[model samples]
Target chain A: MPVFDQGYRRFEGTLRPRHALGALVWTAVRPRLRWWLWLLAAILSFYPGLVYAAITFITLAVGPDAFGGRNRLPEASGAFVAFSDNGDPSQLVAELLAPTTAGIVARLWRISEQCALAGFVLPAVACAGVIATDRATGAHQIYFARPVTRMRYLLSRIAAVTVFCSVATVLPPLLVWLETAALHDDPWFAAQTWSAPFAIALSGAVYAYFVSGVVLALSSTLRRPLVVGLATIFSYLFLQVVSAMIVHGLEDKRWRALDPQYALGGITAPLYGVALPDWLQTPWPWLVGLVVPTLLLAYVWSRLRAVEVAT
Target chain B: MTSTAPVVRVTALEKRFGAVRALRGLDAAFPRGAVGLLGPNGAGKSTLLKVLLGLLEPDRGDAEVLGLRVAADPMAVRRAVGYMPEVDAYVSGLTGAASVRLAGILCGLPGRAAQQRAHEILYYVGLGEARYRRVEEYSTGMRQRLRFAQALVHDPELIFLDEPTNGLDPDGRDEMLALVDDLARHHGKSIVLCSHLLHDVEAVCEHVVVLREGTVALSGSVDDVRKLERGTFHVRVSGDEARFRAAAEAAGMHFAAQDGETLVVRVPDGAGAREIFRAAHAAGCVVRRLATVEQSLEGVFLRAVEGAAEARA
Candidate 1:
């Protein structure tokens, strides 16, 4: 019951609109930074990259001799000891480079996709309680009580999840790609696989944006974080199952786009020069991958605006 | 902002939630200093607060906060006013400091400044030591203080406190009322205190506005509202009660109500203590206590509400 009768002191400092968004994003993400679930998700996200790095190191150590003969070994890789001394060393450089380079790029694409899948845990954890907890605690009313607009609040939530996703999904694969390039020590291999990191980054970003958008959109509609988290995870599995049943029942592969993850892979695989699996191949992935997230995000914006005004 | 000028003004404010009219052509001007907003359930006190904060747009009419039209520039109005909502609301996982800082930031304070003010305001509201604890851990009183801290963190020109003393014990309620009074009287902050507790409002507010059925039932300074009737006094006497009653009635005085050993009598205009003393002497009773009884806020509220109902009917 102590009284603060020093009288109120007016604040003369000016407000910065730019700081508002950053403050909101920071506050939204700060609590989860120390949570064990987020840490576990971060580790899982990098697990694929770690596995890919190990594979690249082993392949580089075994050298072109593992592919066939000494003649198949690139000259640039002669720094390593030869496994076979009796074989002719006159094979074309393309002969030594094509299969191994193709194999490495393919492996990187697979790992990138794996990283995206594992990184689902990041958005699941990051966005689970963001809007749901706010709604439950009535924090959204406090936010709307201030000068904050509905659009700014929605943007901050999406940005926080996107940032978490980038760190968890995009950074690890790029690091793995850098490690792959460094271990090979062959200029020809580096030249052929230079765009692998970009592809990994691009596909990882696409995955992050898509999953974060869908999960956050779900979070906006619910009031319990645990329910939102479970629902988000369930949605992926449900989409996969329902899409597979439809694809098989009608004997049409085009409907595979209904499975967001499959559609995402179809869209991202081309960046690594890999096509969708023969049976699942279709032209719908590009449309589905790009359109679904956009629609969900638009829905989230509308929902937030309604909640702000109605409540 | 002069003392006489209004901190908030609404004209022909009409709001409808489907078929139910929450506010029907409500008009009010809340002056500077402490003003009490008193209303019962579904009286539109909460609706008016929301509209002033720009959280909800009125279906029709003009509203202004700190002279800025809410509809034309709600952000500017929000920048200058702070609100302590009636409902319990706080960021679940955030510490008290973080919650207040977030509010300050949303109101447009720079990050560092918001952080600084968060600490100062929490300490001001007596939560200095508990600033680091998560809001979920706070008690009812502490959470109320936290809400006040967040509302004051930005130091806006006007503050809207809805049911500020809703669940506090006597001591806590006294402390809150003292703080509110100090803010209005000493610190020069305009306050709109909405509460069902008439005593709390009477203790802290200078001006009062009572709402009924989404419209203003009564609005004026507390003194003026209570001063509606004069020459009414509470008289206490120790003598034969039958003789005393006869004597008072004979003196053109009518008993409006009575308490144990005390009589509340309404004296006719131009009547004074002389008439009451004469009546008591004639009754062979000693005048023990005689004092004018100012109408309580409850009386004003009931009269206003019931009067409005009768007029409408």
Candidate 2:
């Protein structure tokens, strides 16, 4: 290691290192984390979890054979009915719910698919105008002039918006999985559905990451917050519309992966052990799904570096 | 940190912007105190400042701020110094105090210390009552004060003020200048004041560096640079102006009338009153009034700029 010279000490008191990244993240997200908005996000996010939980409870209470064709019980009687076979009912129930892990994971994936709009809404609402508004007010000059590095600034802002989106997209589903798993007294239920939480978390992480990155990249390109926000929504819609038109016009469903939501679903479906449809079996969905968001984030980093250095 | 040392040093610094060269082998040193940075548009004042602040990298050369090499450790240099931008810069949706506190925190102060410094600096800058007001709602003067407060909240040893009084009214400008003077004199902070207003610089700064065409045209003490080589005397004579001009020319001096009543004469560098007296006596004119001319910073600035222009041509 090269020895460095310790120059004149400027201050008499103890000096503390600036927690610049933490400060930046807090400052960026604090104003947007209103109670009502968080409550709305929680309600929207937990809706699918609640629905999943209700289904699990109903299945547990009524018996898995209630909906199955194997049962010969009469529909008129409201009393509890069980098989007269010489076997334990609880063990039989555990055996029934054990194989339902695939269904549970598939339901979680479907939850993500159903709330695709929430992914866009949460990140867009959190970071829609963040970079644009800062540029408009020349706040970047002051920020870059401080001791905070450009990378720290960029990462902090991305992480701040990611917090909003991850809370809505990632957390609720995991909690719901935990709660659902706890409802069953089956030990194998824990072992069978152990991967369900990971699947939920992975799918949620991917969605949150892609949406936050793309939204911030869009924010970096424009100067007006309103325009940036509108452009984000419209661009996603436009891609979706164009992709649909092309898929219909060409009569090739593989073109559906050109849409971000469909591309994201392609990635999430397999995480839940669901097979893709014939058209999405191609690598186009995975390619576009991973590359597009990475490219958007790279663009955001470059734009921020340019703005900081070139200013 | 030492009063006798230069707070900023640039050696043969060069910066280019595609086809345009913003800084060309520029060399300058700003001593610890109040120094004014004077330049015309495109004279590399902003470029030099950015380089020193570590916002822009120099294409070729070395720069040091507070004895730390900027290229090697820019963040440290930035932490040691403060910059007040010329533009209206503030984080939107934040109050004045919040803005200052954020700046302090970003500059390496602890959160509580930053809060305390923000409050104290806002009050010191006369924004005490309006500290809670949103920065967007502030008037131009209040915004300018807010900018100053943020720059000073961290209490850096050096501060770069870019057009601090840009949009201030007369009273606000005076107050700002007074604060700058106080910082330099009482607080022992080094300041590099960049402005188009020469009087403002002359009023508060002890030294100045004039830039022309991406290079230092002149740099020295303000009083030393304002000193004219030849003594310029304003002489009011009661007799024939033609004869006084002829006699002044005979004495190897130049004379011009500032107005109908006052004739100005410039004597040789060493010779002074004797030549003016001899010229007046020889011309048979009554030397009613004679006073030496005081050079203005504007005159020095113009000469440096024009001199550099001529040299370039």
Candidate 3:
């Protein structure tokens, strides 16, 4: 055997593989924490309070009779009146708050989901930036020159970025929950009222994961993180707008399933007392919809895995 | 020195980038010493380093590092050899210590040990004070040192430093050179010093491989490769010019020129000094001084590169 071979074997025998997953996650998450913390603070300070304030203001201004009562408008008018027939003011209050609160929560959830979608752009750009910076600063050579292979290095980066996206997606819902608990007194608030928030949070997490995968894929192909980020955002917005236009223009009931907003509407129809079609009711569409984006992201990751550090 | 096989050996290694032939049938060996890879830009120095590291696939031929074939077992080779690349590259947002630790871990060191080794190696490379600082904040010299630290952290037997002193100041350059010397001499590490600076190479390297246009133009020990050309001498004499010239001519010595009280002469190789002394004494010339001129590495490198260029032309 060659001298280096003997030396390497001896060294390998002595050395242990360092599994610093926590350290890696910490390193990846720490930088983005400041931004997320500020976001969490903002969400906590404004969102739940905004919901409570909007509910309180609407209750005072419009009263409980506007929804369903003797005072209900046969001809819709800009008038506020209290009804004598409903009997239960609390139920009326809940009814008054439900749509507005759900609307606010759903909107907030959509915003979070959109942000999660926006986040998909980030990991790709972030990973690409990390790789590109490594190349620019000669770190890629330094890192690759060590015992680490390109695949391991790339995987570590993806892992780190995935952790970062997860934290970003999860933190907002957590802040909203804590804030709601601190502010609200409704017995149904925790059990019944939180379903929308939970769904929004769950969907956001899934979306974030999907986005991270897609971004990692983009990062592998493109060297410039900014280009990847901008391209991703543009592509997503373009797809959303075009898909919406096609769905709305065709008015084909089958194509409605393809529209994400419509799909979401279909999912939430029970809350609005609308009957969903049998095809939309089945689990297959949601499963297929979720799986398609995931598969595309996996395809992206496979492509990224093939990208060699050009430096 | 230990009767072990060569650490690295390359036979007719060739690489091409599409139409651009980067390495053309280059044969070389990196033995157990501080070996210098001297070449100008585009001379395949970087390509050769990458090939040795098993980072790039060779278009033809084969290379073995630490007994691991470059094509067949690159990971094995990488685990055995540490490389400092020619260009500036690093992991962003990581502290200098973190970067080194990451490299150490990838080299298979456990967490605590990797951290400890990272600190020690960084200190060795003069990055002790800056260990906690992010790599983005490091100066060019610090970055270079960190690069060296990463290479050494794995405790690899052979280290490849590509233009290790590129952006350093004079003091930094000297320190880097001293560190490289210490690594080779004291730590028993074999090094491949890839640099365009002939002076830096001469300062630390005992053997050198000079590449010209992707081929080995010359390769040998530093001393042997810089052998002085015959017929050059440094002479000092106090005598009449005419008698001195006549005496030198009569003795079959070629007189080149006179400078002040000295005469430059072309003495035959292996000629005894006593012959010149006697000839000068007979001619009533006082021989003040006599010495032989040695060739500089710069001269040898220039000649080798020029010769290769001429050969190709």
Candidate 4:
């Protein structure tokens, strides 16, 4: 809240509690209500991860003994394992769980990355579509004509998209973890795995925020939401593909800046186990990735504020 | 003579869209009345409303509403004036009540205050029963009323209504017109009613301004503009047309013969039908018909726009 006191008038400087609550509720409910199809699409998008998880689970269940003695494992009961041959029970249990744990971990890592990408791209498309629909139906003029400033309106919209992206990213992995814990009775296993979903969800939300800022900036300029959404998605993909092909050929580090995806990859390499030089991992990329697009969005919003509603 | 300097004032406002000018060096003032903005299509009526609402910037000149400059202190002006856009646009999934309440809160109303005001304004606009209904389910007329409801929910001193009767039935239009009239007449709220329909303006507006090609063509009280081109009178008589013509000419009245039995004469300003009756009686004519021809708003609007266009050419 910011105060503005003129000579004769005393204008209230703080946002009302109801407005903040309404913004949050609107952010949560509007995505599900306005574009349930997109929500469904988001859920369907995790099918690849689900398939990978299932394969890993089956491979782990039928131990390395299924691939011959190159991997020796015992048939295990709920509490412990008893080897049929002369074998150490603790050693057999370790061998049995190692491949399964490693596979699940690898799959989780890949799934988390995919989740981050989907979370960013899906909500960006949905929010742009929603705003475009409002403009097409003349609803934007009515909404903007109210006492609310353009900044408040855009903030509420972005908040809603972020909530949607976070929910989409976190829910699937949690469900999978819950199912695994229910079947395997591995308390340690569940505890070790829970942190991945939380981390993925947090990072995914940040990514979604950045993507939404860019998409909304484009959305304000373009008349058609679908065209804007597709162009943004395809353009990012095209840049990534082209950058991958040409980066190997480039000698200069500046060429990396041409590809946002590569730049983001380099930025997030620390979290993903791909180490960068200690000097390069200074939080600058995180700030740049998030703040630059946000400023661009603010510029777009000011332009929209100046637009006259066509009656 | 000096109350507060009118809620809104504009001096020599001008706006251009590419090569075609929308608002050409126009000056107007809105005091405390339900002022009607009468014009034809492309008359720059919409442009004027947008500029006054602080949504659009003018190419030249300045405007002040409630002592706040529109360009520099738009938020203050916006807080003081409620606007009902020509089109009906509401948050799609929101109920009528919620939408109005949201608008109230955005205007800085506290929770309980916003809710109470929303209820009162919804009832005032005659949508009390349908307050819980989603806006998508509302009819064109209901939505129009809802738009009006949102504008009034904040309890602003001034309101800008652009085509408030658009997409309304005859009865609905009448209801809206009456509501607008009551706001100005009884409550003392100033309003700028922008509409192409003259009848709508004539029903409630005390002051009228006609715009053509972004310039003021005719303005002042509705009576003053209507009186600019006075209506004529047709008197039918069972007497010689030549005699009636001679008498009319002698009296320095402009008269024309229509068919063989009627003499149409221009009714001078301030002269009534009784004068025509007396003239017929003096002429020894059995007056069978005496009809005072009145001009329609459409006719007045066309004549004004055409007059301005011709002058510009």
Which one is best on TM-score?
A: 2
Tens digits of per-residue lDDT for model 1, A162-203: 777776667776776677677766767778888887887788
lDDT for A304 (candidate 2): 90
Off by over 4 Å in 4: A1-112, A168-202, A221-263, A270-274, A277-311, B1-5, B229-292, B295-300
Looking at model 3 chain B, report the run of 10 residues with the lowest lDDT sum: B225-234
Report the poorest 10 consecutive residues by lDDT, candidate 2 chain B. Answer: B254-263
On residues B129-241, what C-alpha lDDT tens digit does candidate 1 reach at each position?
A: 99999999998998888999888998887999989987888888898888888888888899999999999899999999999989998899999977754777889988897
Best by DockQ: 1
DockQ of each: 0.42, 0.29, 0.23, 0.18
Extract clashing residue pairs from model 2.
none
Chain B alone: TM-score in each candidate? 0.80, 0.83, 0.79, 0.80
Which has the better TM-score: candidate 1, or candidate 2? 2
Give the alpha carbon lDDT tens digit for every residue of B1-313 in model 4: 2454576788899998899888888887776788888887888888887787677789998888866788896666766778888876777677899888877776667767778777777777788889999888999999998888788777777889999999888888888888888788877788889998889988998888888888877778777767654646667877865666666556656653354666567656676676666666667767788886575454457667666666679
Those runs of model 2 whose alpha carbons end farther than 4 Å from true positions after fitting are A1-12, A17-19, A39-50, A53-99, A187-195, B1-3, B229-268, B271-293, B311-313
Can you list the residue pairs that collide in candidate 1?
none
i-RMS for every candidate (Å) is: 2.1, 11.4, 8.2, 11.4
Q: Per-residue lDDT for B1-313 in model 2, tens only?
A: 5657799999999999998888989899999899999988889999988998888988999999999999999888888888999988888888899999999889888888888877778878888888898888999889888888878877888999999999998888888998888889877899999998999999999999999889998899998888752477778888887898899898888653355688667787788988888888899988999987778787668656666667769
lDDT of 3 by residue, B95-144 (tens): 99998987777667777778888877877777778899999899999888
Docking class of 1: acceptable
Q: In candidate 3, what fraction of native interface contacts survive? A: 0.45
* Candidate 1 C-alpha error for residue A163, in Å: 3.0
Complex DockQ, candidate 4: 0.18
